[model samples]
Target: MQNSFEYGSTRVKPQRFGDWVIEEITVSEDEAKFFNMRQAFQGKHSEMITAGKFLRLMQVSTGYTVMSNTPMELKSNEIAFKNARGSVLIAGLGMGMILEAMLTKSEVTHIRIIEADMAIIQYVGNFFKDDPRVEIIHGDIHEYEPASDEQYDYIWIDIWDDIDVRNIEQMAELNERFSNHCINMNLWSMDLLGCEPEDYYKIAM
Candidate 1:
């Protein structure tokens, strides 16, 4: 990953929403052995990571669904992380991973985050509550719309539980709402589909 953050910066009690809980998770060495290298960043890496381990920050839902700061998640968001600049708006605050990553870039002047789950904002969002340049909102990405005069340099949509070809429809609806609100916007996993973030516009069209 291109940016690193100190997980210890924030001290808060564990928070949960339904079956999802915002907390740290330790992955065993045996679990790391089966990692798909294609999904993780290979160089420099991020902070708090060891050779056989991943970052501890994570949000776990029922059935062991995880949203974490693991290398795999970093790799998936890397392109957007590098391309993001100026005022950025990110949907889905998963363990505040991408939100914290954006803090490392001086070029990013402001960050606005929207997450559907209030528990996530109460939990993961607490870490950034003191940052003047960041705003955390509780809202649904599918129904939320930006203010009329507000615009962002970049926008990232990452609300899905997982990447699926069926996500294209929702992405298109997002494009319709945000196309003019941002100079460039992206949906996560477009790169995994063998398309650049910019290509997302074309792919959806």
Candidate 2:
């Protein structure tokens, strides 16, 4: 790990993984690099996991929802809390920071996390095994099926692996699933104040 900088409401810092940083929470860098660093960490799976264990240990569950970091306060402070008691769906379940925050709120009833990696899920869930509100789903988001009677208030999508965006129909279906959803669909790369690519960091709320 290295010294950190401020990015929106969170602080960003370089970790062990290639050109990766953490904002608001510390991300895990303990495992072997499983995929391309350029696409996964900064691009899609930004919310799946974080570096710090304390943050994960403190979270109510191992589920999370994250979007753009530039407008951090906008998304964080303006979450839809009305008529939300049944369940909330999250695309990525990183270090469990966002879900941890959701649990702090009085309205959120449960969380269903959809993650492609089971190993990552196990790492986080091993700590919060006692929490009943968190449910981990080990599968791809494209294969997910929503119940006919189910409608979620919030759906956050942040993918770490490369996706086939040529399928517009699939994207549309994802859009229709959540009443409220946020996606960080762009890569935020920067090298500021003598910082390397690893030192660059931004949150894409």
Candidate 3:
């Protein structure tokens, strides 16, 4: 690790691999970041707030914010980590942190992670090169499909950047595609946040 590895809610320094960069490190709480955290981590996570510093992984090409290891994000992925077992199909390859967490579960026999970005698999894939259980494939989640007999025990989708009602539609679309392959399919925060399309609309109004 270049500086410090942050996963499941912790932060330190920024690291980079190819076009992918992880940053937003600070020794003290930045006021703007603090406010953003307060807005996002309100209600239950309000008290757990410590500092505003967090790791941000993003792609410089399209200015697409990849993912973070914030507490909210870590909390969101807990459901998938708990229920993951057997053959698993995961969408997205952010910072390779989730894969690090998934590798801890002995019940998880194999994981086939499908990422749309090729730059990620080229660089981030090096992190998991030693792990035979993980197979990172290059494909778009929307267009990718399994073989005729291909099936999985669990399917986890965290393809979106943040928690939004728009993600629900994406999840539904993915569900329609991969539902038959697994006993359970979990979308990153679709269940963890416990919000729906209606909730987001109400918030907007």
lDDT of 2 at 159: 50
Candidate 3 global TM-score: 0.77
lDDT of 2 by residue, 1-205 (tens): 1123222222212122212223344334652134335437665443233233221112224233223232222233233222124467766655554555555555666778787767546664454556687788898887877665665545555453223434334444555543223221111111111223221221234
Off by over 4 Å in 2: 1-86, 160-171, 177-205
C-alpha TM-scores of all predictions:
0.75, 0.45, 0.77
Instruction: Enumerate clash totals for all models, in the order shown.
Output: 0, 21, 0
The Cα error of candidate 2 at residue 25, in Å, is 11
Output the number of the TM-score-best candidate.
Answer: 3
lDDT of each: 0.68, 0.43, 0.71
Model 1 misplaced stretches (Cα beyond 4 Å) = 1-18, 23-30, 35-51, 55-61, 194-199, 202-205
Ranking by TM-score: 3, 1, 2
For residues 60-89, could you state the per-residue lDDT of candidate 3 as single tens digits? 777777676666566677777787788888
Worst 10 residues of 3 by lDDT: 196-205
As for lDDT, the candidate ahead, 1 or 2, is 1
Count residue pairs with overlapping backbones in model 1: 0
lDDT of 1 by residue, 1-205 (tens): 3434553223344455655655556666655543434235443222123234333433454455555566556666776677678999898887776777678778999998888878778767878889888998899988887789989988988877666667777877887788788877878876554554564642223
